[model samples]
Target: MTIQAAFTLIINTLGPLQGNREAANIAHIVIEHITGMGRMDRVIYKDKLLSPAQEEQLQQALNALLKHEPVQYVTGKAWFYGLEFTVNRNVLIPRPETEELVEWIVKDTHTPVKILDIGTGSGAIPIALKKDLPAATVWSVDVSAGALEVASQNATQLNLNVHFEQIDILDTTATHSLPLFDIIVSNPPYICESEQKDMEEQVIAYEPRIALFVPDNDALLFYRQIGLLAKEKLVPGGLLYFEINEAFGKEVVALLEKQGFKNVILKQDLYTKDRMVRGEN
Candidate 1:
Protein backbone atom coordinates (compact mmCIF):
# COMPACT_ATOMS: atom_id res chain seq x y z
CA MET A 1 0.00 0.00 0.00
CA THR A 2 1.10 3.56 -0.62
CA ILE A 3 2.04 5.80 2.32
CA GLN A 4 -0.82 8.13 1.42
CA ALA A 5 -3.27 5.26 1.43
CA ALA A 6 -2.12 3.98 4.81
CA PHE A 7 -2.24 7.48 6.31
CA THR A 8 -5.81 7.91 5.07
CA LEU A 9 -6.81 4.62 6.62
CA ILE A 10 -5.30 5.60 9.97
CA ILE A 11 -7.05 8.98 10.08
CA ASN A 12 -10.45 7.59 9.06
CA THR A 13 -10.17 4.77 11.58
CA LEU A 14 -9.00 6.81 14.58
CA GLY A 15 -10.70 10.17 14.03
CA PRO A 16 -13.69 9.20 16.14
CA LEU A 17 -11.44 8.11 19.01
CA GLN A 18 -9.42 11.33 19.03
CA GLY A 19 -10.19 14.57 17.19
CA ASN A 20 -9.19 14.98 13.55
CA ARG A 21 -5.97 16.94 14.19
CA GLU A 22 -4.83 14.57 16.93
CA ALA A 23 -5.69 11.57 14.77
CA ALA A 24 -3.60 12.97 11.94
CA ASN A 25 -0.70 13.64 14.35
CA ILE A 26 -0.84 10.12 15.68
CA ALA A 27 -0.93 8.76 12.17
CA HIS A 28 2.14 10.80 11.25
CA ILE A 29 3.95 9.66 14.39
CA VAL A 30 3.19 6.01 13.64
CA ILE A 31 4.41 6.41 10.08
CA GLU A 32 7.53 8.19 11.26
CA HIS A 33 8.25 5.47 13.80
CA ILE A 34 7.90 2.79 11.11
CA THR A 35 9.71 4.59 8.31
CA GLY A 36 12.29 6.42 10.47
CA MET A 37 11.67 9.39 8.17
CA GLY A 38 11.89 12.88 9.52
CA ARG A 39 8.92 15.25 9.23
CA MET A 40 10.06 16.79 5.96
CA ASP A 41 11.03 13.40 4.58
CA ARG A 42 7.59 12.01 5.35
CA VAL A 43 5.92 14.94 3.62
CA ILE A 44 8.14 14.53 0.56
CA TYR A 45 7.44 10.79 0.49
CA LYS A 46 3.71 11.08 1.00
CA ASP A 47 3.10 9.20 -2.22
CA LYS A 48 5.78 6.56 -1.52
CA LEU A 49 4.70 2.97 -1.10
CA LEU A 50 4.91 0.92 2.10
CA SER A 51 6.03 -2.70 2.34
CA PRO A 52 3.60 -5.41 3.48
CA ALA A 53 5.31 -5.55 6.90
CA GLN A 54 5.08 -1.77 7.37
CA GLU A 55 1.34 -1.85 6.60
CA GLU A 56 0.82 -4.59 9.18
CA GLN A 57 2.60 -2.62 11.91
CA LEU A 58 0.49 0.48 11.23
CA GLN A 59 -2.67 -1.65 11.38
CA GLN A 60 -1.75 -2.98 14.82
CA ALA A 61 -1.20 0.55 16.14
CA LEU A 62 -4.57 1.61 14.76
CA ASN A 63 -6.25 -1.29 16.55
CA ALA A 64 -4.71 -0.27 19.88
CA LEU A 65 -5.76 3.37 19.46
CA LEU A 66 -9.31 2.24 18.68
CA LYS A 67 -9.31 0.43 22.00
CA HIS A 68 -8.74 3.76 23.83
CA GLU A 69 -5.11 3.05 24.69
CA PRO A 70 -2.97 6.15 25.01
CA VAL A 71 -0.58 6.86 22.14
CA GLN A 72 2.36 7.16 24.57
CA TYR A 73 1.67 3.63 25.78
CA VAL A 74 1.23 2.49 22.20
CA THR A 75 4.64 4.01 21.35
CA GLY A 76 6.27 3.33 24.75
CA LYS A 77 7.54 6.95 24.87
CA ALA A 78 6.35 10.26 26.30
CA TRP A 79 7.82 13.77 26.06
CA PHE A 80 8.08 15.79 29.25
CA TYR A 81 9.85 19.08 29.83
CA GLY A 82 12.40 18.84 27.00
CA LEU A 83 13.16 15.11 27.05
CA GLU A 84 11.46 11.86 26.08
CA PHE A 85 11.05 9.10 28.66
CA THR A 86 9.95 5.49 28.37
CA VAL A 87 6.48 4.77 29.69
CA ASN A 88 4.33 1.68 30.29
CA ARG A 89 1.26 0.51 32.16
CA ASN A 90 3.31 0.65 35.36
CA VAL A 91 3.66 4.45 35.40
CA LEU A 92 1.43 7.43 34.79
CA ILE A 93 2.12 9.30 31.53
CA PRO A 94 3.82 12.60 32.34
CA ARG A 95 1.58 15.58 31.58
CA PRO A 96 2.36 19.23 30.71
CA GLU A 97 0.98 20.49 34.03
CA THR A 98 3.55 18.44 35.88
CA GLU A 99 6.21 20.04 33.70
CA GLU A 100 5.05 23.37 35.06
CA LEU A 101 5.64 22.05 38.57
CA VAL A 102 9.19 21.16 37.57
CA GLU A 103 9.73 24.56 35.99
CA TRP A 104 8.64 26.24 39.19
CA ILE A 105 11.24 24.30 41.13
CA VAL A 106 13.98 25.07 38.64
CA LYS A 107 13.08 28.73 38.67
CA ASP A 108 12.81 29.16 42.44
CA THR A 109 16.02 27.60 43.62
CA HIS A 110 19.75 27.84 42.85
CA THR A 111 22.12 24.93 42.44
CA PRO A 112 23.98 22.84 45.06
CA VAL A 113 20.75 21.94 46.83
CA LYS A 114 19.38 18.59 47.92
CA ILE A 115 16.08 17.64 46.25
CA LEU A 116 13.62 14.80 46.84
CA ASP A 117 10.76 13.87 44.53
CA ILE A 118 8.01 11.72 46.07
CA GLY A 119 6.07 9.34 43.79
CA THR A 120 8.58 9.72 40.98
CA GLY A 121 6.66 7.93 38.23
CA SER A 122 8.83 7.71 35.11
CA GLY A 123 11.36 9.78 37.11
CA ALA A 124 10.11 12.84 35.21
CA ILE A 125 10.47 15.23 38.14
CA PRO A 126 13.96 14.29 39.28
CA ILE A 127 15.29 13.67 35.79
CA ALA A 128 14.10 17.04 34.51
CA LEU A 129 15.36 18.81 37.60
CA LYS A 130 18.75 17.11 37.40
CA LYS A 131 19.05 17.99 33.73
CA ASP A 132 18.29 21.64 34.38
CA LEU A 133 20.14 21.93 37.68
CA PRO A 134 23.19 19.79 37.01
CA ALA A 135 24.71 20.37 40.45
CA ALA A 136 21.66 19.55 42.53
CA THR A 137 21.64 16.31 44.51
CA VAL A 138 18.40 14.69 43.28
CA TRP A 139 16.63 11.61 44.68
CA SER A 140 13.27 10.05 43.84
CA VAL A 141 11.14 7.41 45.56
CA ASP A 142 8.13 5.33 44.51
CA VAL A 143 6.11 2.42 45.87
CA SER A 144 5.96 0.32 42.66
CA ALA A 145 9.10 -1.62 41.81
CA GLY A 146 7.99 -1.79 38.20
CA ALA A 147 7.69 1.97 38.01
CA LEU A 148 11.09 2.35 39.62
CA GLU A 149 12.57 0.06 36.98
CA VAL A 150 11.23 2.30 34.21
CA ALA A 151 12.46 5.41 36.05
CA SER A 152 15.90 3.89 36.51
CA GLN A 153 16.12 3.05 32.82
CA ASN A 154 15.12 6.60 31.91
CA ALA A 155 17.69 8.09 34.25
CA THR A 156 20.40 5.92 32.71
CA GLN A 157 19.31 6.67 29.16
CA LEU A 158 19.24 10.40 29.83
CA ASN A 159 22.67 10.11 31.45
CA LEU A 160 21.42 12.02 34.44
CA ASN A 161 22.43 10.85 37.90
CA VAL A 162 19.32 10.58 40.09
CA HIS A 163 19.10 8.39 43.16
CA PHE A 164 16.10 6.01 43.12
CA GLU A 165 14.61 4.27 46.13
CA GLN A 166 11.46 2.25 46.88
CA ILE A 167 9.34 3.75 49.61
CA ASP A 168 5.62 4.01 50.24
CA ILE A 169 5.20 7.63 51.24
CA LEU A 170 1.85 6.91 52.86
CA ASP A 171 3.60 4.67 55.35
CA THR A 172 5.47 7.16 57.53
CA THR A 173 7.65 4.42 58.98
CA ALA A 174 9.19 3.71 55.59
CA THR A 175 10.42 7.30 55.13
CA HIS A 176 12.25 7.58 58.46
CA SER A 177 15.57 6.64 56.91
CA LEU A 178 15.34 9.23 54.14
CA PRO A 179 17.77 12.13 54.30
CA LEU A 180 16.82 15.79 54.72
CA PHE A 181 16.18 17.87 51.60
CA ASP A 182 16.46 21.50 50.64
CA ILE A 183 13.49 21.05 48.32
CA ILE A 184 10.74 18.39 48.33
CA VAL A 185 8.32 18.06 45.41
CA SER A 186 5.48 15.69 44.56
CA ASN A 187 2.70 15.28 42.02
CA PRO A 188 1.27 12.44 44.04
CA PRO A 189 -2.07 10.63 43.67
CA TYR A 190 -4.52 13.43 44.34
CA ILE A 191 -7.59 12.31 42.42
CA CYS A 192 -10.46 10.98 44.54
CA GLU A 193 -12.26 7.77 43.61
CA SER A 194 -15.49 9.68 42.92
CA GLU A 195 -13.67 11.66 40.22
CA GLN A 196 -12.91 8.54 38.21
CA LYS A 197 -16.08 8.98 36.21
CA ASP A 198 -14.81 12.34 34.98
CA MET A 199 -11.48 10.98 33.65
CA GLU A 200 -11.07 9.80 30.07
CA GLU A 201 -11.31 6.07 29.46
CA GLN A 202 -7.77 5.98 28.06
CA VAL A 203 -6.40 7.19 31.39
CA ILE A 204 -8.71 5.28 33.74
CA ALA A 205 -8.26 2.02 31.84
CA TYR A 206 -4.57 2.07 30.86
CA GLU A 207 -2.71 4.20 33.44
CA PRO A 208 -1.75 2.94 36.87
CA ARG A 209 -4.59 3.61 39.30
CA ILE A 210 -2.16 3.59 42.24
CA ALA A 211 -0.51 6.67 40.72
CA LEU A 212 -3.78 8.50 40.04
CA PHE A 213 -6.19 8.03 42.91
CA VAL A 214 -6.85 8.34 46.62
CA PRO A 215 -9.83 7.16 48.66
CA ASP A 216 -12.84 9.45 48.27
CA ASN A 217 -13.21 9.97 52.00
CA ASP A 218 -9.51 10.56 52.42
CA ALA A 219 -8.84 12.79 49.46
CA LEU A 220 -5.81 14.40 51.05
CA LEU A 221 -4.09 11.19 52.11
CA PHE A 222 -0.83 11.71 50.23
CA TYR A 223 -0.76 15.43 50.90
CA ARG A 224 -1.30 14.92 54.61
CA GLN A 225 1.34 12.24 54.91
CA ILE A 226 3.87 13.90 52.63
CA GLY A 227 3.32 17.25 54.33
CA LEU A 228 4.04 15.75 57.74
CA LEU A 229 7.13 14.05 56.38
CA ALA A 230 8.38 17.30 54.86
CA LYS A 231 8.05 19.03 58.20
CA GLU A 232 10.66 16.63 59.51
CA LYS A 233 12.77 16.04 56.38
CA LEU A 234 13.01 19.60 55.08
CA VAL A 235 15.91 21.69 56.33
CA PRO A 236 15.28 25.09 57.85
CA GLY A 237 13.68 27.35 55.20
CA GLY A 238 13.26 24.34 52.89
CA LEU A 239 10.51 24.37 50.28
CA LEU A 240 7.75 21.81 49.59
CA TYR A 241 5.86 21.68 46.31
CA PHE A 242 2.80 19.72 45.16
CA GLU A 243 0.63 19.44 42.07
CA ILE A 244 -2.68 19.29 43.88
CA ASN A 245 -6.28 18.53 42.95
CA GLU A 246 -8.01 21.79 42.05
CA ALA A 247 -10.97 20.83 44.20
CA PHE A 248 -8.81 20.62 47.30
CA GLY A 249 -6.20 23.33 46.75
CA LYS A 250 -7.25 25.37 49.74
CA GLU A 251 -7.53 22.29 51.86
CA VAL A 252 -4.01 21.18 50.96
CA VAL A 253 -2.60 24.58 51.71
CA ALA A 254 -4.43 24.55 55.05
CA LEU A 255 -3.08 21.09 55.85
CA LEU A 256 0.51 22.26 55.35
CA GLU A 257 -0.06 25.40 57.39
CA LYS A 258 -1.56 23.43 60.24
CA GLN A 259 1.59 21.32 60.28
CA GLY A 260 3.63 24.51 60.89
CA PHE A 261 4.65 25.16 57.29
CA LYS A 262 4.74 28.88 56.56
CA ASN A 263 4.13 31.05 53.49
CA VAL A 264 1.64 28.49 52.13
CA ILE A 265 0.62 29.46 48.62
CA LEU A 266 -1.65 27.99 45.94
CA LYS A 267 -0.98 28.66 42.28
CA GLN A 268 -3.09 28.04 39.18
CA ASP A 269 -2.03 26.30 36.01
CA LEU A 270 -2.44 27.69 32.49
CA TYR A 271 -6.09 26.62 32.62
CA THR A 272 -6.59 28.81 35.69
CA LYS A 273 -7.42 25.83 37.89
CA ASP A 274 -5.77 25.74 41.29
CA ARG A 275 -3.34 22.95 40.43
CA MET A 276 -0.09 23.68 42.37
CA VAL A 277 0.77 24.53 45.96
CA ARG A 278 4.01 25.43 47.78
CA GLY A 279 5.04 25.89 51.39
CA GLU A 280 8.18 26.55 53.40
CA ASN A 281 9.53 24.87 56.53
Candidate 2:
Protein backbone atom coordinates (compact mmCIF):
# COMPACT_ATOMS: atom_id res chain seq x y z
CA MET A 1 0.00 0.00 0.00
CA THR A 2 1.11 3.57 -0.56
CA ILE A 3 2.49 5.45 2.45
CA GLN A 4 -0.35 7.93 2.21
CA ALA A 5 -2.92 5.16 2.26
CA ALA A 6 -1.41 3.54 5.36
CA PHE A 7 -1.11 6.87 7.14
CA THR A 8 -4.78 7.63 6.56
CA LEU A 9 -5.88 4.22 7.84
CA ILE A 10 -3.85 4.51 11.04
CA ILE A 11 -4.81 8.11 11.72
CA ASN A 12 -8.52 7.36 11.21
CA THR A 13 -8.25 4.42 13.61
CA LEU A 14 -6.43 6.15 16.46
CA GLY A 15 -7.39 9.76 15.88
CA PRO A 16 -10.64 9.58 17.79
CA LEU A 17 -9.09 7.87 20.78
CA GLN A 18 -6.95 10.90 21.70
CA GLY A 19 -7.91 13.66 19.27
CA ASN A 20 -7.37 14.53 15.62
CA ARG A 21 -4.30 16.59 16.40
CA GLU A 22 -2.61 13.88 18.46
CA ALA A 23 -3.52 11.12 16.04
CA ALA A 24 -2.06 13.08 13.15
CA ASN A 25 1.05 13.76 15.18
CA ILE A 26 1.44 10.12 16.17
CA ALA A 27 0.85 8.98 12.61
CA HIS A 28 3.67 11.18 11.38
CA ILE A 29 5.97 9.95 14.15
CA VAL A 30 5.17 6.28 13.46
CA ILE A 31 5.80 6.70 9.77
CA GLU A 32 9.09 8.39 10.49
CA HIS A 33 10.11 5.58 12.79
CA ILE A 34 9.22 2.86 10.30
CA THR A 35 10.44 4.59 7.15
CA GLY A 36 12.86 7.10 8.70
CA MET A 37 11.18 9.86 6.69
CA GLY A 38 10.13 13.21 8.13
CA ARG A 39 7.00 15.10 7.08
CA MET A 40 8.73 16.50 4.00
CA ASP A 41 10.15 13.11 3.16
CA ARG A 42 6.76 11.49 3.65
CA VAL A 43 5.29 14.04 1.28
CA ILE A 44 8.07 13.45 -1.20
CA TYR A 45 7.41 9.73 -1.05
CA LYS A 46 3.64 9.87 -0.69
CA ASP A 47 2.99 7.90 -3.84
CA LYS A 48 6.07 5.71 -3.46
CA LEU A 49 4.19 3.31 -1.13
CA LEU A 50 5.20 1.28 1.89
CA SER A 51 6.69 -2.17 1.47
CA PRO A 52 4.88 -5.19 2.99
CA ALA A 53 7.31 -5.36 5.93
CA GLN A 54 6.91 -1.65 6.58
CA GLU A 55 3.13 -1.96 6.44
CA GLU A 56 3.21 -4.74 9.00
CA GLN A 57 5.35 -2.67 11.34
CA LEU A 58 3.04 0.28 10.96
CA GLN A 59 0.04 -1.91 11.77
CA GLN A 60 1.66 -3.13 14.97
CA ALA A 61 2.36 0.45 16.09
CA LEU A 62 -1.23 1.38 15.35
CA ASN A 63 -2.47 -1.46 17.51
CA ALA A 64 -0.34 -0.26 20.38
CA LEU A 65 -1.63 3.27 19.99
CA LEU A 66 -5.22 2.07 19.92
CA LYS A 67 -4.55 0.42 23.26
CA HIS A 68 -3.55 3.84 24.66
CA GLU A 69 0.18 3.20 24.74
CA PRO A 70 2.05 6.49 24.46
CA VAL A 71 3.37 7.33 21.02
CA GLN A 72 6.82 7.82 22.50
CA TYR A 73 6.83 4.24 23.79
CA VAL A 74 5.39 3.06 20.49
CA THR A 75 8.31 4.76 18.69
CA GLY A 76 10.90 3.88 21.38
CA LYS A 77 12.07 7.49 21.40
CA ALA A 78 10.95 10.88 22.67
CA TRP A 79 12.30 14.40 22.22
CA PHE A 80 13.28 16.50 25.22
CA TYR A 81 14.96 19.86 25.27
CA GLY A 82 15.24 19.41 21.47
CA LEU A 83 17.28 16.22 21.90
CA GLU A 84 16.03 12.70 21.29
CA PHE A 85 16.17 10.05 24.01
CA THR A 86 15.17 6.39 24.09
CA VAL A 87 12.15 5.57 26.26
CA ASN A 88 10.23 2.46 27.21
CA ARG A 89 7.52 1.37 29.61
CA ASN A 90 10.10 1.48 32.37
CA VAL A 91 10.68 5.24 32.29
CA LEU A 92 8.39 8.21 32.19
CA ILE A 93 8.42 9.95 28.82
CA PRO A 94 10.13 13.31 29.17
CA ARG A 95 7.73 16.22 28.89
CA PRO A 96 8.12 19.80 27.63
CA GLU A 97 7.70 21.29 31.10
CA THR A 98 10.81 19.43 32.22
CA GLU A 99 12.68 21.38 29.58
CA GLU A 100 11.97 24.50 31.59
CA LEU A 101 13.59 22.85 34.60
CA VAL A 102 16.67 22.10 32.53
CA GLU A 103 16.70 25.68 31.32
CA TRP A 104 16.57 26.86 34.90
CA ILE A 105 19.60 24.73 35.73
CA VAL A 106 21.65 25.76 32.70
CA LYS A 107 20.94 29.43 33.29
CA ASP A 108 22.51 29.28 36.73
CA THR A 109 25.79 27.77 35.53
CA HIS A 110 27.94 30.86 35.87
CA THR A 111 30.87 28.53 36.60
CA PRO A 112 31.74 24.85 36.57
CA VAL A 113 29.81 23.11 39.31
CA LYS A 114 28.80 19.67 40.56
CA ILE A 115 25.25 18.67 39.64
CA LEU A 116 22.96 15.81 40.56
CA ASP A 117 19.60 14.83 39.02
CA ILE A 118 17.31 12.73 41.20
CA GLY A 119 14.92 10.17 39.70
CA THR A 120 16.68 10.80 36.43
CA GLY A 121 14.62 8.65 34.08
CA SER A 122 16.10 8.47 30.57
CA GLY A 123 18.81 10.79 31.93
CA ALA A 124 16.96 13.61 30.20
CA ILE A 125 17.69 16.18 32.88
CA PRO A 126 21.41 15.47 33.22
CA ILE A 127 21.98 14.93 29.50
CA ALA A 128 20.29 18.17 28.51
CA LEU A 129 21.97 20.08 31.30
CA LYS A 130 25.39 18.69 30.32
CA LYS A 131 24.86 19.35 26.62
CA ASP A 132 24.34 23.01 27.41
CA LEU A 133 26.70 23.38 30.36
CA PRO A 134 29.62 21.16 29.43
CA ALA A 135 31.77 22.26 32.33
CA ALA A 136 29.47 20.94 35.04
CA THR A 137 30.05 17.57 36.68
CA VAL A 138 26.72 15.75 36.40
CA TRP A 139 25.45 12.61 38.14
CA SER A 140 22.01 11.03 38.17
CA VAL A 141 20.31 8.46 40.39
CA ASP A 142 17.25 6.25 40.11
CA VAL A 143 16.01 3.30 42.11
CA SER A 144 14.97 1.20 39.15
CA ALA A 145 17.68 -0.67 37.29
CA GLY A 146 15.53 -0.79 34.19
CA ALA A 147 15.13 2.99 34.31
CA LEU A 148 18.86 3.40 34.87
CA GLU A 149 19.57 1.19 31.87
CA VAL A 150 17.45 3.40 29.65
CA ALA A 151 19.03 6.54 31.12
CA SER A 152 22.55 5.19 30.64
CA GLN A 153 21.83 4.19 27.07
CA ASN A 154 20.48 7.65 26.37
CA ALA A 155 23.61 9.25 27.79
CA THR A 156 25.81 7.06 25.63
CA GLN A 157 23.77 7.68 22.49
CA LEU A 158 23.84 11.45 23.08
CA ASN A 159 27.58 11.21 23.81
CA LEU A 160 26.87 13.04 27.02
CA ASN A 161 29.06 11.92 29.92
CA VAL A 162 26.81 11.50 32.95
CA HIS A 163 27.17 9.06 35.80
CA PHE A 164 23.99 6.99 36.34
CA GLU A 165 23.58 5.14 39.62
CA GLN A 166 20.82 2.86 40.90
CA ILE A 167 19.86 4.30 44.26
CA ASP A 168 16.62 5.33 45.91
CA ILE A 169 16.43 8.91 47.08
CA LEU A 170 14.50 7.90 50.18
CA ASP A 171 17.38 5.75 51.34
CA THR A 172 19.13 8.71 52.87
CA THR A 173 21.53 7.00 55.24
CA ALA A 174 23.42 5.45 52.36
CA THR A 175 23.37 8.53 50.10
CA HIS A 176 24.69 10.68 52.91
CA SER A 177 28.26 9.68 52.05
CA LEU A 178 27.94 10.80 48.46
CA PRO A 179 29.82 13.86 47.32
CA LEU A 180 28.40 17.34 47.67
CA PHE A 181 26.75 19.13 44.76
CA ASP A 182 26.49 22.75 43.65
CA ILE A 183 23.08 22.17 42.07
CA ILE A 184 20.63 19.34 42.84
CA VAL A 185 17.70 18.89 40.50
CA SER A 186 14.86 16.39 40.07
CA ASN A 187 11.67 15.70 38.11
CA PRO A 188 10.58 13.27 40.78
CA PRO A 189 7.28 11.40 40.97
CA TYR A 190 4.95 13.87 42.66
CA ILE A 191 1.66 12.27 41.68
CA CYS A 192 -0.36 11.07 44.63
CA GLU A 193 -1.90 7.60 44.47
CA SER A 194 -5.41 9.03 44.62
CA GLU A 195 -4.70 11.02 41.49
CA GLN A 196 -4.09 7.87 39.48
CA LYS A 197 -7.79 7.18 39.00
CA ASP A 198 -8.13 10.53 37.28
CA MET A 199 -5.13 10.20 34.95
CA GLU A 200 -5.59 9.10 31.38
CA GLU A 201 -5.80 5.36 31.06
CA GLN A 202 -2.76 5.29 28.79
CA VAL A 203 -0.71 6.99 31.50
CA ILE A 204 -2.08 5.20 34.53
CA ALA A 205 -2.11 1.79 32.90
CA TYR A 206 0.94 1.83 30.67
CA GLU A 207 3.50 4.13 32.28
CA PRO A 208 5.68 2.83 35.09
CA ARG A 209 3.70 3.02 38.31
CA ILE A 210 6.69 3.37 40.65
CA ALA A 211 7.89 6.36 38.67
CA LEU A 212 4.50 8.09 38.76
CA PHE A 213 3.07 7.68 42.24
CA VAL A 214 3.61 8.54 45.89
CA PRO A 215 1.44 8.07 48.98
CA ASP A 216 -1.94 9.72 48.53
CA ASN A 217 -1.44 11.88 51.59
CA ASP A 218 2.22 12.63 51.02
CA ALA A 219 2.42 14.09 47.55
CA LEU A 220 5.44 16.13 48.52
CA LEU A 221 7.43 13.12 49.69
CA PHE A 222 10.12 13.30 47.06
CA TYR A 223 10.41 17.05 47.25
CA ARG A 224 10.79 16.85 51.01
CA GLN A 225 13.29 14.02 50.85
CA ILE A 226 15.30 15.62 48.08
CA GLY A 227 15.11 18.97 49.81
CA LEU A 228 16.70 17.50 52.93
CA LEU A 229 19.32 15.78 50.81
CA ALA A 230 20.10 19.05 49.09
CA LYS A 231 20.63 20.58 52.48
CA GLU A 232 23.06 17.86 53.45
CA LYS A 233 24.66 17.12 50.08
CA LEU A 234 24.82 20.59 48.58
CA VAL A 235 27.25 23.34 49.33
CA PRO A 236 26.01 26.35 51.23
CA GLY A 237 24.19 28.48 48.62
CA GLY A 238 23.72 25.45 46.40
CA LEU A 239 20.64 25.44 44.18
CA LEU A 240 17.70 23.04 44.20
CA TYR A 241 15.37 22.57 41.25
CA PHE A 242 12.26 20.44 40.77
CA GLU A 243 9.69 19.75 38.07
CA ILE A 244 6.69 19.67 40.39
CA ASN A 245 3.07 18.72 39.89
CA GLU A 246 1.17 21.89 39.08
CA ALA A 247 -1.31 21.26 41.86
CA PHE A 248 1.41 21.22 44.52
CA GLY A 249 3.64 24.11 43.49
CA LYS A 250 2.77 26.18 46.54
CA GLU A 251 3.21 23.24 48.89
CA VAL A 252 6.55 22.30 47.30
CA VAL A 253 7.84 25.83 47.71
CA ALA A 254 6.73 25.74 51.29
CA LEU A 255 8.49 22.41 51.83
CA LEU A 256 11.77 23.92 50.67
CA GLU A 257 11.30 27.05 52.74
CA LYS A 258 10.46 25.00 55.82
CA GLN A 259 13.77 23.26 55.23
CA GLY A 260 15.41 26.69 55.18
CA PHE A 261 15.95 26.90 51.42
CA LYS A 262 16.01 30.57 50.42
CA ASN A 263 14.87 32.35 47.31
CA VAL A 264 12.24 29.72 46.70
CA ILE A 265 10.58 30.44 43.40
CA LEU A 266 7.84 28.68 41.43
CA LYS A 267 7.86 29.01 37.64
CA GLN A 268 5.12 28.12 35.21
CA ASP A 269 5.13 26.17 31.99
CA LEU A 270 4.12 27.47 28.56
CA TYR A 271 0.53 26.91 29.64
CA THR A 272 1.13 29.04 32.75
CA LYS A 273 0.78 26.13 35.16
CA ASP A 274 3.06 26.25 38.16
CA ARG A 275 5.38 23.39 37.15
CA MET A 276 8.95 24.26 38.04
CA VAL A 277 10.46 25.32 41.36
CA ARG A 278 13.92 26.61 42.29
CA GLY A 279 15.49 27.43 45.63
CA GLU A 280 18.88 27.86 47.23
CA ASN A 281 20.28 26.12 50.32
Top TM-score model: 1
lDDT, model 1, position 17 = 66
Candidate 2 residues 103-198, lDDT tens each? 877877899999999998888999999999998899999999999999999999999999888888899776976799999998888888888778
lDDT of 2: 0.89
**TM per model?**
0.97, 0.97
Candidate 2 error regions (>4 Å): none
Model 1 vs. true fold: TM = 0.97
Across 1-281, the per-residue lDDT of candidate 1 in tens digits comes to: 87778888888888876778998998887887778787788779888989889888888888898899998998888899989899999999999999899999999987589999999989999999999999999999999999999999999999999999999998888999999999999999989999989889999999999999999999999998999899999999999999999999999988999999999989999999999999999
Report the lDDT of model 2 for residue 187. Answer: 89
Choose the strongest candidate by lDDT.
1
RMSD of each: 1.0, 1.1
